[model samples]
Target: MATSKPQVSPELSKHYSARMVAVFRYGSLAIAGIGFIQAVIFAALGSWVVVAMELSAFVGGLAIYFLIRRGHLAFGILAGQAALMAIAITMGLILDVPTADAPRISHLYLLVLAALGYLNYQRGKSRAQLVLIGLCLLAFIVLASAPLTSPFVVLPDMARTIGTWANAVMATTLLAVCIHAMQAEFNRKDKFSRDLMTALWNDEFQLAYQPQVDLSQNTIGAEALLRWNSPKRGAVSPVEFIPQAEELGLMVAIGGWVLEQGCRTLAEWSKNPLFRHLSLSINVSASQLMHRDFEAFVRDTLVKTRANPHRLILELTESVLVTDIDLVIAKLDGLRELGITIALDDFGTGYSSLSYLRRLPIQQVKIDRSFVQDAVNSSVSASLVKNVVLMSRDLGHTVLAEGVETIEQHALLARFGCIEFQGYFYGKPMALADFEQRIEARIKRLA
Candidate 1:
């Protein structure tokens, strides 16, 4: 039997950006090495002033590296970009003379900084970073057009030639490394996205039924969870792929498949006395609800499968509400008119106002697991859960506290007047065959 504590999987965004940490760490070290090598070359050429400037660059890179290691990643990136721009501008204007053999190549480094700045800004959306990137571009254009009068610490012909080649190679190599890492990350994601498409075509995904119970511990229903067991990647968590699916515009198609399978299961259960009364909840994404033919699709599925509409519950997250409210309400109401129940899933974790509870055609409110798990220990969580139950009841919406992984949590929720429950505490999600066997076992025990 699977354990009661369901493992929490990180969301896809977190997983997707995890590679950036490694990239930055190694990239910082590489930058520091480049600075130190340049300093050494200058020292060998007896250019004391240039050697000092190069050593400062080395120190600056190390400072950024240490800052990142200390968990100040944003600050580290900002500092690194700022320092690189300063060095490039200073060198292009003063130290790096435009010789006949080696024109001012220091300005080219600004282009690299600009690229890095853009990448950082995309991730953080910082206005300051955007401004810095603009400055880098401006500096690059200005420095490339004409060399400034000041040529302090002019390098010897030998040093300028050697430095030009060294600077070009190092800067180009740095840019190449970053691009390569980014390209590899993109390729991996692209491959995964392709795999997802192929998975749908090959039927690599299956549904797992997790039992939902009443406060009395009696099984009432199950939530149909989508599971993907990739042949190459083994068991992939929905948390790691669902967002990608949505971004790829594949969620509507995937959700349709889930609905079809769920309706078919309802049809199968209608013939079994033991499971006929059970309600099956399926999560609906924003894309699915907003689809033009969603209402017709659900209506047709119900008619084709001959499944009881009352036995189907559509769980929707708060994100879905951030759309055309009237349109959403109309679609939900249409589903409700057909005897399908609409549930607000992951309640209290979104930007939805209390006014939505009164306005939307929500038949049930599924309390998010974060609040439920902390309810027993956190006064704030307990109070929130209590109020949600009261408010849901007052609004004529059934309350289900999901992620009730312990007896204490279940008891606390019951005391708070929550009637319905779903979580690992009751039973982990299992295959359809296993779910049927579990239901039969429970029925026999009760008899």
Candidate 2:
């Protein structure tokens, strides 16, 4: 009973790049080790032809390792997995004969290759990756049932028996490693989902308002950005957690809380002369908008907080329109009935259909930061920004350019007829109290 130790190098790697490097580094070594061991066994069995095949695996694996270390990540992954599949199939057909006691187990490595192939595809979507995965799966199934008649010298009975046990041990060990890596990611997400629910209940989730300003550089409004300071994980970016929340079906609840808090803030602002006219834009996820009672929820929050509906802007991304355009429009119309303004956020980043834009009850268009940042250098981006401004304004949508980080970018956006803006150039997202104080100071200076 020989137990094989599994390689789990990616257990502690956090970022995707780090995980990728760790997997490739360890996976390549493991492959090479398998090849080396098989080559030694076949050499002892006097299977010279099989020894050459095994040595090829050893060399191929080592080549992939060097390629990966040299930063040829994509090529390394594709070549390594493909080579692994070829070797697995060749060896399974030639030597791994299924017996009553020793079943054909070499083909089992194909399943591991399939898993790795899927992971690679997930990292980067490509047709070649899909083909590799399909080949692995097909090879696995076909080889599991029948082995082709080998022209090359086959392994002896004793060698087949030893090889079966070795293959079973190694294949299962590698398979477990893949499963553990995948399960680790799932477990992290599960833990995050639970933590998110607790954070919602404990009021750990917060909204930081990034100021949106007019051309006059006066603070006119702000977008409420979600932030979380987990006691266990420290401060987690919305980039990392928002999509998770959406996937876990928790965004609706989180959105409701944000709406409530935003409305309350609006109500408080209404009492201040300077802040009375300032609008607050709160982002609405596709799921939140599609929620059957989203309109009623907003109405209830408005009624409860007595927030001025005119001062509340719900920012919807272009991606949301892909879900159900008619339903989205209906929801927007219903929300509009409450006097809450609708603003399309992250413009030019998704499917922006003229027909859908014409139908959506939107009052504003936000130029995504990518365009704004690149507008200064790239003519294509600049022209796109200019055209988006013209088109959005033509549709009577107030255009706001986001991610304006410099005075030069700000000047370019202003020149392009985008009057309203939101970005770090004006002010970064800050606490509500700080935002109000900043706004107050600006008002004093204007006076």
Candidate 3:
């Protein structure tokens, strides 16, 4: 499945950009070393100034390495490189340095300096770095054109000087091309991610209602679970994408859609008397609950869908209760006052499971699949399940064991007085039509 575009925070984006710049800085330094070697060989059998300049560039690169290793700002390293280039320009002006036949050599140095300055500008927050980059560019321009205008006999021939100018222009063009390409690729990936998310939001996803049964009544009470029916990838599980959606701040919208869809399904089911009494539960994530208007959202959805609030159960994980216990209690109490039932989902999975049960005004505890899966074989898991079910019962909360696939597991749970059960043994998650039919068949059998 095509992944949704991740919504990275500004601080995180800057951190990622800094890391990328660090890698690029090292790569550029290596390339600069190669260029310096060529410059040294070309100017050999001649001036000592070329050797000194090459040594200066090497030393400057070492300083940049230490700065990066020490966790200093990457832009600071680029700024230091610009300063070294300025020093080189000053030395060339004072010494009247000899330039080899390769005029491109001088232009290459100017281009590298300009690139470092521009990158520093990109990574900088304050205007100082930008201003520094502008100064560096201006200096490079003067240094590059000096051979053409001055009595400094660096490049004595006009052809050599013209070649130098051409090389500088070419290098500048290449840098621009690289910048443009990076920006284009970033934009393209960003747009693709946005489009993928939009599609997911626009009902490209499907909903599956898993039957949560009341073991006492042998009747199915459905819980609406989200299933993404991607056009390209078939079915995408909520376990995979919901966390990403929450991180991107898209969970509220997606949760709203699920609420509406679930209520609508309940209203439709209510038409059949046999299915009318089946309570439909929907899982609400912590992010959805954190919204200030969440209580109103739920109330409004019930009113709009004409579904009975009492029959609409909102399943919340224990993690939500622990994060902000007072807030959760306040919100849940308000929900209960509205006659909306709340179920504490995946009950024993959290850190402070027992403490949360006492604090939150919850009506039911859906024992997590982990304990239920192991209850048939493992004594430890069975003991844990028995304790949870007994505690919940003593506390006057309904306990439901999930993932009961075997008759033995079902019989074991029944022995422990777990009044509610749900899993593949009763029935796999089915479409709305199939579920209604199953409800009818089960009702007839009971009758």
Candidate 4:
């Protein structure tokens, strides 16, 4: 038995780009080190001032790279690195190239600076970067004028060329760098998607169970929530990747995994007499349920797990049933015949028609959290919850108020004839190990 329920992880963006930025900086640091070492080897040929500037850049780049690797000051470091590259290139423009070089060093450096800026432009410094790039381009024109455009920036005897060729080379280099950056981004995303495809059977996914309690504050059932923790991507929300899975034709496989895992949990929990009669509910996607073999799969899962069919519930959103009502109805009927409970989850937020209630074999309707959350403060919301409860009773279906977080909210819903309740108030979703202990403890207490 466990002592505490599983704590909810913090809400975070699944598609965070910080990892990629860190990886990019890791490469940049190596390049900066190489540049500094090259400068040292050729110190005798170039201006000492140029070597000194490269020294500072290399040292600063090293510091920034380590800071970003530690995940410290990420946004600031990304923006600063972009600005630093632009500045270093601009300043390096005034330096004498140690070896034979193109005469349009200033123009080339400016375009390179612009490309760096554009690559890191969307890293939270949009407008400032635009100004920086614009200034760099404008400086090219400013430097072309009389005093700024001296033929010999250094020695009087040094020959120079500022023809159509220099401009074309600069333009071509900038375009190629931009194209390369875009292609790199595309490749990064492609690799992430492919990794997720391979991750399905790699034990990267799992389920969390949130208890559903009745009016007496005793646990009777739970909703099994799907969660994934990717090795490369960190924690991923079903909200973020489930749609992607549907598009990639991975949902059927993922959904099957959920069903099997949920059944396995039930089989394990069946050891405790308290959990023997408890219902386990799992969400099914429209496509998952629409599959011809879905019923057979469910039946086989229950038989294999030795879980009673009466204690298994399959939840589907009301909107899912609207498009192919006839086909869905036929499929759902077969599920009900197996003594599996069917529920309408997130009930009121969708197009909830009495027609669905009358025609479908739904055993319960979960009142969407919106109305339950507002029921305490809003009279209209309270009335709506009451109406839903009464309607469900009239139609021989039970009502479960979801997201009931406060005593006042719970009291109001309990008065409205809601038979079962679920939310943060009763218990958060917990791991199977912790939830099993919770069930044992609660049953003992009630006894």
Q: Of the candidates shown, which would achieve the greatest TM-score relative to the real structure? A: 2
- 76-96: candidate 3 lDDT, tens digit per residue: 455565666665465446433
Write down the TM-score of every candidate. Answer: 0.77, 0.78, 0.58, 0.61
Q: What's the lDDT for all of these models?
A: 0.84, 0.81, 0.67, 0.68
Ordered by lDDT, highest first, the candidates read: 1, 2, 4, 3
lDDT of 1 by residue, 214-331 (tens): 8678889999999989998898878667867877999988998999999999999999998898899999998999999999999999999898999999999899878999999999
Residue-wise lDDT of candidate 4 within 215-302, one digit each (tens)?
A: 7888888888877789878886665567567667788888898888878877866886667878888888887887778889988988
- Arranged by TM-score with the best first, the candidates are 2, 1, 4, 3
Instruction: Report the error of model 1 at residue 170, Å.
Output: 3.9
Across residues 14-118, which tens digit of lDDT does each residue of candidate 2 receive? 123455567767888898999899899889878888788889889888988887777677778788888888988887887665656667788898998888777
Alpha-carbon deviation at 37 in model 2, angstroms: 9.4
lDDT score of residue 147 within candidate 4: 36
- Mark the regions of model 2 whose C-alpha exceeds 4 Å error after superposition: 1-106, 117-135, 149-170
Candidate 3 vs. true structure, TM-score: 0.58
